[model samples]
Target: MKDFKFVSKTQETLKIALINFALLLIFVELGSLGWYFVKHKQFFYTREKTQNKSDLGINLEGVRLNQSIVERFHPFFGFIQQPSADFRPGFKVNNYGFISPYDYPFKKNKKNQFIIGIFGGSVASDYSIFQIQNKILPQYLKQLPGLQDKEFVILSFATGGYKQPQQLLILNYFLALGQELDMVVNIDGFNEVALSNLNNKNQINLAMPSIQHILPLTSLANNSLSTKAMQTTLRIQENKTKINQGLESLQHCSFAACDALTSVYVQNLVNNYRKDVVAFEKERGQNQQDDEGSVIYINKNKSVLEDSAAFEQMAWNWAKSSIFMHKVLSASNVPYFQVLQPNQYYQTKRVFGEAEKRIAFNNETPYAKAVELGYPALLSKLPNLQKNNINILNGVNVFDKTKDAVYVDSCCHYNKAGEVVFSNYVGSSILESLRKDEARSKKK
Candidate 1:
């Protein structure tokens, strides 16, 4: 009876200790949760106080990309801008799907319509936009003799990320369609160098479209992973989109961290998403070997990243494209001139202020290195362009004297002031060259 009492007392004590430990855990959990939320409340905005105005107040215009822009492949050229896919108010894509908010009409009603088609990549596109708004170049040309009576209209063939042969292709395609161009001014060089090297880096054909053009299409070609990934990713992305846009409202929550519980849920979803994406990519890579028919990948000659020999070949290809363009234009009796667009990467070419340094210069980008290495090769081929009877203007020194910020972006783009200087120089060169030629013809 004494031994039984001792064992029963020990069992009762163990039960009491376990119950007290469980109670302490529950107390600690509640206390911690309450403290975390209370600390957040003291500093963070409340949904009631802020009135969820962040959704309305936030301007994502600068950050928002043109993913909404629908792209379609062209037979002659790689892709043209499709009609009106952008959601921004008053912004419209042309019928040809080029960047401008205008149309390339088939019918030319005006007689002596000297349509000066501007060709090149995005910098050229910006120049076209400037010309369309200001009429700077045409005005300068009009001041020259024998060009006054001609009705000049701007036709922009420039697209973002277009390189050599694409410009040549664009010129040929339009001319084949019975569109008349009196002159062609191709603004290029940067795309020809940067994007071609990029193509080789991506292990694709140099003749193929830039990686930006092809990379988005790569995911959709995954055979088995497509259907599975699309379903899961669609749902997750839908939730993520709502969360990012602040469209999914939670009770008494603000922008910063929203609600901790909701944050936990989002984080969980993100972890699952990351896991899904990795699996999707892995399976996609494996599938590409087996399902080659789905992708337009060719086992073409690919050089390693930023090879000097490869860069030389790219510059040669650029010159050759210009030569080909000259042949086509000459056969049609149209004057063709190419302006090698100015770049920030050209060493000691421009003096960068703090603004330019921050926004326009990135030493880490492949562009700086590409320009540094590839530009010498490209510049060396300038004589090759000139030898082909192509009136090529080297615009590298366009901003040499100007201490102001000319380059707006890191990837070889010019601002409004840059545009103004470039356009004036281009216009003046064209006019003066034509005048000199005219005077020579008269003397002869």
Candidate 2:
């Protein structure tokens, strides 16, 4: 009778263990679902499209979103700008893949049209604080009696993360397509510095190693865990800080520790948020090499030059490309200008907002340091630009007068208010150039 009692008790204990195991599994499943919901709803902005392209008058014949830009596959430049699905401000793309709100053909309109093609990276691509083409800068400029009679058609051919050579390729493509441009302005600097130094590659078109390739997987995973633990502590401390106004925000972790956490956070955020979309959504090599003649791979056996020297060489290459483009445009008597876009890193005496402060504090990355170190090299080449007969605008100094915040989310981009400053600066410079050209014509 005692043995029977012992067996029955053992069976009861086994049943309880199984029940607890089942309950634990259920809890894990529920927690995963909750995490997934919060991640998607709070972080990702995804939309499903059921509308036909024909209804929108958009031809998706050779288009792909390599980096979230609705760009068409170009044989010469890798990709060219198209109307992006990411954001909308009532803008339309021309049939040739140029972003334009007005109904105009890709070719010159034969109306004495003063066609200006503005090319650069994302800042100049209307991916910043404002859709540059939709802004009132052009309208404001047209109101000037000096420009009232002229028909202005400003075309934007810029793309995010594009370097100077890409702009040159775009110009070459335009020249090939028989589209005449009056003044081609290239706004650059940040992308050139960032891409050049980050990859340790002197050339622009070569693909740089991704963050996953740069950082060790083991370190990334371990650091990720450490960050999460620190974040939990930070959150609790922050709550206390809120309650006690005398407490410092960085009571738990040092600034460097926080920055390390932030770097990992940004990397994970990008990995989690970016759609698992392949390049061109097809087998690679759909887009033939556009940089065949221009790209010259640096010899790795030679000792690596200092960051400044390498950056200066990169700047010189850009200047040479600009010179090549000048010859290309001068064939049609088209004037061209290169504007070195302003960056927050260059603004030494600028005030920082809360969001700006976070970005500023996280500038220890190789990419950020490269931009900071390499910018001076480019700026020092201004005399070389002048010697080449290139009318380059020093946009690096454009933000000096504005006491208000100029930068937006990133290091190089600016707010709409900042965009106004940029537009006015470029407009005034363009106006001055036009006046000089007109005066020269009168001399003839």
Candidate 3:
């Protein structure tokens, strides 16, 4: 009788536990379903509105889609049929619509022809400014006296976050497309160390996936929620402020409370920004891969300040790769120039003095070191090339400004004024080089 009672109790306990487990799972499933439905609804509503508007066509959050379109149409992809329409702006519908942007029509020319391909990361893309004043090289070149009548088209397709290897790959791709470019200008330095240290070979491979490429969709969704919340909070505070202002008796008291709230909000904003930077670093560290297919362990032993040598190595590696790229272009008989874009710290009075210098020292600025190296490693193949009567130009020192040329608080990319100055310098240098080359050929 005792044994039977014990067995019955055990069975009852097991049954109750199993029932609770099922109920817990059902709750979780329902919660997930609710979240998913809410997200889907939000996405649907937002996209429906955007669809009625003009389509930006390709994703501009990352690299320009024109390059991707060309890559997809490569013979390896096996879709040899011509595009139904010209996707590029200003082009009419044609059978051979998939030609390179380098091949795009410029104004009809009289006789002398020159094509210069400008390559870099975001700085080269000229995203932040108006199209006419955004990029300096092409527009500047067009203004040159000798090149005024020449057919010159500057094909700049560089995007942000591209490393030296990626730039080299792009260079090769353009060459393969049969672009007889007179000069290929490579502007890099910012992305090299960060990209190489943070991203690995596998991460790079996974990065370009069509599904994963839509990864920004998640961020866009989150940002929409955030923006909506911010607007709502601001509206409430604004209403409160107006109410307080109207009420004379309560005005002083409400003012104090409002000021305090504003202070708190501002502090929260600063804290969030700091947190974002930290989180980004952590994510990058976690995703970093090693040569043996293992995640590269970011050293927790030392702070960024303490790990000076490692940082220098990162910059050095980037410089070496840039040098390698220069050599590659030289060997291919491709005209190439390296344009150095200045960082915010490099040009700002606010960031000037010892503090900024220390930060720059810690980060290991590549252009400064490249200047010291003075074109040896960059032009290693040049001695042989001189024998063949070929020469390459270095435009790295052109935009090295002593003071901040960009907008206040911004770094690296230039503002309109800076862009104009940089483009003018580059344009003049290129024309001079072209003239020199012409003179040499004529003498020979």
Model 1 — TM-score against the truth?
0.69
**Residue 84 lDDT in model 3?**
39
- Choose 2 or 3, whichever is better by lDDT: 2
Per-residue lDDT of candidate 1, residues 206-232 (tens digit): 666665554434545434345654565
Worst 10 residues of 2 by lDDT: 276-285
The pairs that clash in candidate 1 are 81-97
Best by TM-score: 1
Candidate 2 Cα outliers beyond 4 Å, as residue runs: 1-74, 80-87, 92-98, 102-105, 109-112, 127-146, 201-305, 353-355, 359-361, 440-444
Q: Model 3: runs farther than 4 Å from truth?
A: 1-114, 127-146, 199-285, 288-334, 345-411
Residue-pair clashes per candidate, as listed?
1, 0, 4
- lDDT of residue 345 for candidate 3: 32
Cα displacement (angstroms), candidate 3, residue 152, comes to 3.0
